[model samples]
Target: MKRLLIFYFLFFPVFLLSEKRDVYAISDGKGNIKLFWLTSPKNYPSGGWRIEEEKTNKVIEKQLYCGREEFLNALKEEEKGLAKNFIKIFKDDDKEKKGKKFLIVLEAMTNWNFAQAIGIGYEIKDVPKGKVRYKIIGLDESGKKVGPHFLSDFLDSSVETLPPDAPENLKAEIILREVKLSWSQPKEKGVIPSVFFNVERDGKVLNLNPIIPSGEDSSFLDKEPPSLMEVNYFVYGVDVFGRKSIIKKISIYVPDLKGMVPPENFTAEEKSGKIILRWKKVENSSGYIIERSNLSNSLYEILTPKGIQPDMEYYEDSNLQGGSVYYYRIHSYGRDGKIGPPSLVAFAQAKNQTPPPKPKNLKAKVGRTMVQLMWDRVDFPVAGYRIERKAEGKEKWDRLNEKLTPEPNYNDITGLYTQGKFKYRVIAVAYDEKESLPSEEVEVELLDTVSPNPPRITNIESFDGVVKIYFEPSPPEEDVFNFLIVRGVSEEDPGLVIGEPLSKEKREFEDKFVKIGQRYWYRVVAIDKKGNRSDLSSSRDINV
Candidate 1:
């Protein structure tokens, strides 16, 4: 019984398929009118069927369906109601040979709603051969039906479908004060959709209609500036399906600060020979002006027109007098016509000056064998001075005293040879230790008056790792003015050693560095306690 039941179910579908009619529908590509025909079922015994379209319950187009003859006649009648000239009807036989399929185009009819009226509908029946059948249906130009060619039907059921009500929740978001806005795009199938956004500000909509590419961002920049004060605007989004979303509104506010009171905090200062000024920067101040004047004068000068930075605490007045005093002040201005009070008074004094004059009447003289130097005192305070002398025809001058008395006179005649000519000069010095130019030079020659005999050698000793050769001049009053010691390897050829100069009243003299086994030569010259030296005595060789 189950096998029989399965057999009957399969056979029942075949019988029903055989009794089904083959229907075909077509449009003239332009109107609300459509033509449809149905072949009579074999058992039903009807030869053909008729079709009709109605609006507001009134028939718009009624026709009988036959073969190609009836299809062409119905298409001609429908064309009368179309506003556009291009009209066509596709047939099954024509599509089969050309590897094409039946296509229909129908005009959209308005049922009182303008947004809903702008659409076209098409239908295709008997798609598959024999017992199996399919119908294809679609909509075209549902909004703003202005174009010539549009999609009306789907060839396959697997093709993606789209929503019938366009996109919902279309909105505009004002992202910033610069009139930047964003919106949501429409969702559709089979075709990549494009979006367009319109912006309106200050009662006038912007003329730029920007097309948003597929999958691109849905934001826009409203570069057009709005009016002063608060502004109003409207925005909307349009999709590639000729569908437009609802409008959105936005408001913006702009402020003014004119005629407002400005604040103050300006200041100034006085530095070396200059006036420096500065002021505190106002929040919106364009710039500041600096004015200056001498405390004793009435004329004031503007220093800087552009306001200074609030943190730039100081400025310089590089043109002030060296010994004169000056005063300075500063002022600040703002864009709101506000003026700041003058800064505190600042005073500056110039520097002092006092320079020393040169010395005068410098002279040098010779007394006996000593050279005497003298100079007039300088009016200014001074440290001790120096005396300089040079022998006649010598290239270098010698300093007699490193730093002598503050007095103007000096006697520097020691260490001079008899019959030798010499020159002498003096220099005056100031408290800062600055020395004046040298005094006028005086040249003099010394003459031998008397001679003193050589003293006897005595008291040879060694001290501090050094050998000291001492001698005593005979007759203490006699002047043993100068002495000489010479050293050599041999006594008979002993070389003379030079000795430093000594005073005439001195009795003893010490010679340093007498090495053992080395023969040394000694000679002493003396005058009878006078300003003279005796002839060299025969050499004395000392061995240690």
Candidate 2:
């Protein structure tokens, strides 16, 4: 009994193992290998095993599997041996031939165990100079299969290339200020078409629409035109295949001031010793009326009747006195008693009748190294006058005096420091201080003088990022002189003085520092070598 039991345990398992079959094949596109195994009647599990390449050797991917129908279907469709050659045998021959085939795809270029178990195979298509490969593997019954096999040789690799061309029948139109667009579908079936349109104005992209379906006509009216008034626009087109066509420009004119009356060009200016007013012709104007006022007056006086041409823009005011200022305005009256708003204010000053009086003898004198000038005031009861002077080397005379009194004599003659000869002249003042005819001038030469007094520092103040020092330069005999600036932070630190010995005529200096939010105190003084130094100017304190 013990011996029989031992034989039964071992023999039963062996009998079951023989009932199943493992089948596989290899393919290199052009050729194929197959296997067949004799087996007793037994049902195999629906899934199968596979083998693939890892650089060199054929490796098994044990757990890797696929459905029978899917495996067979992939083989028939692709004609790739990797999946089709691996078959599961059954008791019925016809059923075996018709069973589905599952093709298992494994990631190439990896060391994964399951990927190795399935043999790697590929299908190839024409790509440039080389073949474009799609990888696949196989699965079979008994959970044992071989190959991701190469099946490129089995495929038709010939392919055709087409030149890029515009999508057919592309058209765009503007409707009610919106752009409506349409285009023909691509020749290649199942190709997704994309469309793009842009609204352009003055070579600028005013609006853009992208990624629309082909064969679709659409409108994109710009709700807001580029400006408050009307403008022109153009349309551009592009198809899904990235083909673009020339732009179609369209002009759109928007009316300005629609239904509103146009304004006439009303102008006012001084002419013929009077205020003249003019305007453009108004077709239906009843007549034009002129208004006048003084500088201080606010009321306007109408001076014309109806039925007069609004185009007869000219109007003159002769009832004004000389040297008087006046303001004028105009308006249009319709037959319906409608009056336009007052035109812009026009102003004119009456021409001057009084002549300017002759300037008195103008004389120049030398004081130390400086030239002192004096003249008799203008004789007329006028506004004012100007003075002019020129040196021997100068080509043009310069105005040296202005707005002198109406008295008989005046004195200036200051700021002349040059040693050469100089000439001078004066003119009378007219209306509004306008200078009139010139008076004869006298020539004079300035004498050289000794150095002037040095300037003195008066006061100092410090503020944010800067220190301000104030001083007065020494007054010299010659008024035409400039001053130099110098500064120092500490009173006792002579070495810390910032600049060379500055001119005594300098009045102020500002120093900048990097430190902030600090308090500083400063002092200034005025000195003149020719004159005594004034007492040190007041000191100032500031925080920066």
Predicted structure with the largest TM-score when compared to the true one: 1
Q: Write the per-residue lDDT of candidate 2 for residues 1-544, one digit (tens) a residue.
A: 0111111122222111111113212222332211111112122223432333333334423433322343344333433343334333222355444322212211111111212222222212222232332222343444433432332111112332222223445454433324344444334322111234555666766554342322234334554443223466655544222334455555543321111122367666666656676667656565666777876358876666543464575777766554667777666655544455565676778764455666777777667545656677655456556667787988898865544555544454544344567777777776545456677768876654333454455666666677777766445524424443433344443223354444534556777852576555454433334332333333345566
* Model 2 misplaced regions, further than 4 Å: 1-267, 278-327, 330-343, 347-358, 361-386, 392-396, 401-421, 428-437, 445-544
What lDDT score goes with residue 481 in model 2?
49
Models 1 onward score TM values of: 0.24, 0.23
User: Can you write out model 1's per-residue Cα lDDT over 424-526, one digit (the tens) per residue?
Assistant: 7766665434556765667767654546665666655555545565666666543555555444556566455556666654555565556655555565655
Count of backbone collisions in candidate 1: 18
Each candidate: what lDDT?
Answer: 0.43, 0.44
